[model samples]
Target chain A: MISVSKLLCGLAAAGDGLRYDDPSGPDQITEQRQRKPVVVWNTTKGCNLYCEHCYAGAETEPATGELSTAEGKRLINELAAFGVPVVLFSGGEPLVRDDVTELVGHAADRGIRPVLSTNGTLLTRERARDLRDAGLAYAGVSVDGLPETNDAFRGEEGAFDAAVDGIEACLDAGLKTGLRYTVTERTVDDMPGVIDLLHDVGVDRFCFYHLDYGGRGAAVQDADLTPAARRRVVRRLCDLTREYHADGAEIETLLVGNYADAAFLVEYAREELGATAARRVYEYLRRNGGDPAGERVADIDYRGDVHLTQFWQGYALSNVRDRPFGRIWTDTANPLLSRLRTREDHLSGKCADCCYRDVCRGGSPLRALAVHGDPFAPDPQCYLTDAERQRDVPPADGNGVSEPAD
Target chain B: MADMRERTRVERSSGDGREWETFVRQDPDSSLRHVGSVTAGSEGVAYEQAATLFGDAADIWLCPAEDMCRYAERPLCDRIEDAADA
Candidate 1:
């Protein structure tokens, strides 16, 4: 996840230090998070609503062989032992599982911060309270667009209302909650309205996810925004984030699933904010160590299979049931996992030649694989033009000024 | 007695019987009640069974049958009676 607000606007969010590696970052929590990868655990595969872009291909019926409560607790113990900072309890919809709070509590008890990613339709007042009491740090409720658009995307007519109620429930229960919006061509127009509606409802954080081709997401690949459209949307989000901050709202806006945003932010800053601001953004992006996947992020599916990232579920390194998660993660016997660790060395085509390769890290390998059938192929989703990408840019100096290239 | 013991051993190892017992509560105010049992090769399978059968339940708990220790001298008892009495 790229913190557009932090990189471009210099906003200091609670977790900004984790991504930007800010030297004077406020707390020990940020330092702790910097050392560990955030783990996304798909607790269950059962969901009430079948979303159009469901990455897990979630269904109403539970998939066979979901990790039991005992297994889940054990997994949490292993993650904590491995020094994982955060565990995002996600799923087709996490609330569909009866042990949602129990798992969240287990993660917390083991000293790992627990967060939730859910459709929110099932997040009733009681449920929200239970999750908060169980030590849930935050809950990101998916809201694709405004009522009709979101309802259509979710494949349920009343889902929009239910989800809003769910968000309200989380807010009333005193649980820190935010909106998770997947940016797609079909729903881009509603972004502003959704933000306005939810912001009024007390949600201050908005995560805009680029559509990654995976699971049901692959089916709607065509619905992904065009390069131009994506640029416009990202610019709008950056503008909105700055506007919100200027108004003293401190709204946190993040872009997820695309490293292109890193380069885009730098360019945007240079063109709009000035060269010094651009250099600062570039330095922050470099510190972020781009395209986290096999480095700073991991996913453990319902059956305990660990993947490089949540969206790269097509491949699995090892199962927690078969071996400890940390052991599996460190094994690196799997060539793909090993290669992903230093992916810049193996990046191909435009990604290899691009001046921003150090910052963008070839964008999303999963998207490249889905589109080009090559993990190392240049990211088809990189919106930066040939001239922009090929520019002989200088590295940022210690003083946030660009040093001449050798 | 020997036959019963042998049968129990076979059942535990065969992986065909309902080795996992599941419980569920309808809501926070409700008491957890034993819903059913499922045959599973691993903890993940057992969870899927419980979740699928009681997806709408407010809470669900699963336990391996072998992990359960009865207080009485029941057929499934695996612990010493004195341990419970103490």
Candidate 2:
């Protein structure tokens, strides 16, 4: 239940859009973005495959990014200097960095756990073992569907098999392995099969994403994700999670689709866990879940990582003197997130007057800006976008009891 | 024994080809057999205690010695392998 204080805060938020967009609004942007953050360090811009659906298509290679061992050390030193507890290192392929093992060791020395996201094509048993030895905590592999389906999307013949092998290798090595499945128009048809594959591969958990219409797939928007498809996908994923829980596997169900379910889950989880813990889970999802650009830190592809916006640029943050990757909570000054965050969100046309405002946050700043050209604007697909009372959702059962729903 | 806090019964024929019906409760790691005998490992439950109730499936094969041990020793919940098969 919302406290009168928070309710008042909600009222305050209603005025924030007005204040923030005002020419006379105080210079609060920097203050808003100055909070402590989890940062990504791009180690390499080199990759091996050329996936058609990849947002980082042309940028996943060494030429796009480069940082010598010394340069890599400098970035780590800077994060440590700022007392940053976690640093995500990504690249064209972090595993390609010759000093990745060393970088992992350095991160371990600094008491930072390195987690990563990769296609898993280069994640051989030996490499996984080596990375584990080097103190890489976990690695997420990208596998869309079963072999026939997955291999096609990955644009590699043996990618599915390699990913399977990578998961087994990581499990055997006693390292955590997660599967990343990007949803696209082609992949939505096989949601059940995709869920089954997540089990068959025996991954510890899986992260789901509907096809992001950016970079490589941007031009293919018609063939990309449909809002209806995303809802269907999240519903199935929610059920799959229920089954996994019944079977006794630890499952964290995530919806990287239209923000509808994600928004609801956040409110529900918050009511169930209360405030502080809920905030942590939300931040954890943003940082540990896939970054918009999928920029990995030193762990996944140790070579060099790129920003979510720089994926197709094919370059490295290490190549430059200062790291260029965006911070999750500290992007107010960031041109991309700033431009996206300022405008009226697509859902704002509806969310501004609704109780679900805090939960949905006017839908994703990234996605709404992608479609409607304004992050602060109301989401076009939002049921509330049309001002229908039928579209508003109850906050939750204020008793803080969550009846499990599959 | 299944270590589950709750469970739904699912009956299937075992490779041993025994037409025995069993209800087991299990957790993520283990299960407790509450019916027809499958594996006969000594799970430390007493036997003769249920001898009177063994009248129907008492073909020794239907009610293995260990099954009695489990039923006899374990109350409602216990941690033992295949205790549910009991």
- Top of the candidates by DockQ: 1
Q: Tens-digit lDDT track for model 2 on A24-119?
A: 111111222223233445466566666666654435446522556765665555455545445555554666677777877777676655666677
* Span of ten consecutive residues with least summed lDDT in model 1 chain B: B7-16
TM-score for all predictions? 0.78, 0.60
Quantify how close model 1 is to the true structure by its C-alpha RMSD in Å. Answer: 12.4
RMSD of every candidate to native, in Å, equals 12.4, 28.7
Question: Candidate 1 regions off by >4 Å?
Answer: A11-32, A392-406, B1-86
lDDT, candidate 1, equals: 0.76
Candidate 1, DockQ score (0 to 1): 0.02
